[model samples]
Target: MSTLQDSGEKPSIYLHRLQVALSVTIKRGGISPEKADQHLLKQFCRGCWDNSLIADLQLEQKKMNPPSFAELLLLLRTEEDKCTAKATRMKQHLGASKQRVLSHSQRAWMSSESEPDVETTETTPSQEQRKSSSAISQPRTTTSKTQRGKPKPWYCFTCGEDGHIASACDNEPNSVLVTTKRKQLKEKQRLWESQNPSADQSPHMAFIQTNGL
Candidate 1:
């Protein structure tokens, strides 16, 4: 039943529900608030039937004259276009900023992965130089030791050692005596040769003298 205006008014719940339903129907119909005939169009538009607010609308209709619905809707659509363009620009700015942050993060990650944080032992120039010097000195030290350890020839006169005469007894120095003995032996050989001139002749020599000469 239609409630009387003198009966105080509709319940708050009923009015709230009615407004919600009207708003939903208006949006679904794409009817901008500008085109809505706040007076004559009390029911939800777009063929949705509702007569609950007919009396209230009639009272509101007597209050004022609104602009043409179609023209007002056109103005409303233009305003919406401006709002949509502003939203699109804001979205693009947000996307570009997000991409920039992501790129910086990825570059940092790759650098960390490529060059790891490993600890290494570092050698100073002095240490390296000392190592090289030790390497070079090793071979010279070995060569000196080899030369010092080399064996000399054994020359013992009692055992008739290598390259030893009777004068080199017990490895004593007899250089003067050896030279004197050598000179005496040479003189003896010369005297013997003068005493026996034909003593050195062989059988072959005798034969050659008797036959050929």
Candidate 2:
């Protein structure tokens, strides 16, 4: 009997022993009597007499039961192959997806790079041409006769003459006949107030008197 301490094996060896013992117990009592017999036979071939030989003996016993061992190993191998195939397929699919995404991004970048940028072009004529054109067009405009090299006459509002405006007119009736009658009235009031110094009235009182309050 090889002790774990003597063999310098890990403590896990003890755990493995416990697992084997439990497995044997469950096998012998967990099933029908006939199944227990088969289990016992199986254990004998497995050489599971002690913990030290458990793993190696189990492999040997499985070989002795060739049909069952082959079937179980084949199934496990097939399942592992299937898992490997699935993992490979998934990795390839992801790679293709990434390539497609990168291709699309590159195409978009290229399209933007290939596009032409539009710019506005401004062209202004020379200053001399602009000045000449302005000078040529100015004389074509019509000017008033009085403003065309002739002094304008002042019109008298009283007699409809052209000597002086109503303000400078000597005739009182002519001043009253001015086109700006309101201005003429204000000027007349100002003159009257200047001549008469005795007029003493507040603006509010004047407003009330005018309104007949």
Candidate 3:
């Protein structure tokens, strides 16, 4: 049927229908074989069908004989199969490329999830508390040593006087002279304490020593 030219049939099916149309036209007989070829070529698009096969058909007709329609149909089928195979290969390549891209994306997502966060790697509260306690405990021993080893003031220890010893209390010396007189006063106080173990031992002696005098 002429309508079969536009149908979504395979190229081989359309070629078979075209051969039937040619046979029916030839049996009706007013037009010659050459005229039938020209009529069919006009009814169908030369470029949409195979231009090379149409040229071969015309060449065969000029030799005073033509191939059978079945032979022509076979050539059309061969070209169609080659085109179909090429299209199938192109589709396969496209599908493989999409799979590779999906694999890469999945790998990146897995690596991101596997890594540890910065906040999670940091020190815990218990570790921080231990460090603070050690720091607080360290200062106590150092503070006690500083308190016990501190230097005494420039004053007499026995009588609690500013400038002179208990034996020189009658002289009443100026306080400014104490800096040069401190060593000699310390010697005399040492000798007095050594000789009089049960002497005055006044509360002022304890006060002077405790106050770092």
Task: Tell me, by TM-score, which candidate is best.
Answer: 3
- Per-model TM-score, in order, reads 0.19, 0.18, 0.32
RMSD of each: 61.0, 54.2, 55.5
In model 3, pairs of residues that clash are none
Model 3 / residue 3 / CA error / Å:
5.4
Candidates 1 and 3 compared: the better one by lDDT is: 3
Could you give the candidate ranking by TM-score, starting with the highest? 3, 1, 2
Which residue window of length 10 is worst by lDDT in model 3? 112-121
List model 3 lDDT by residue over 34-73, tens digit each: 6654544444333234445445446335333434343544
Query: Which digits, one per residue and each the tens of the lDDT, describe model 1 over residues 1-213?
Result: 122121221222222223334344455775565544552123222122223332333423533554333333333344435534544454366443343343333222122222211212344337776577567656765544332211211222233333332222355555565455546645754564565555543532442232221
In the range 16-43, model 2's lDDT, one tens digit per residue, is 2322343445545654433433443354
Candidate 1: residue 8 lDDT (0-100):
20
**Best candidate according to lDDT:** 3
Clashes within 3 Å, all models in order: 0, 1, 0
Give the per-residue Cα lDDT of candidate 2 at 7. 27
Which lDDT values do the candidates have, in the order given?
0.36, 0.36, 0.44
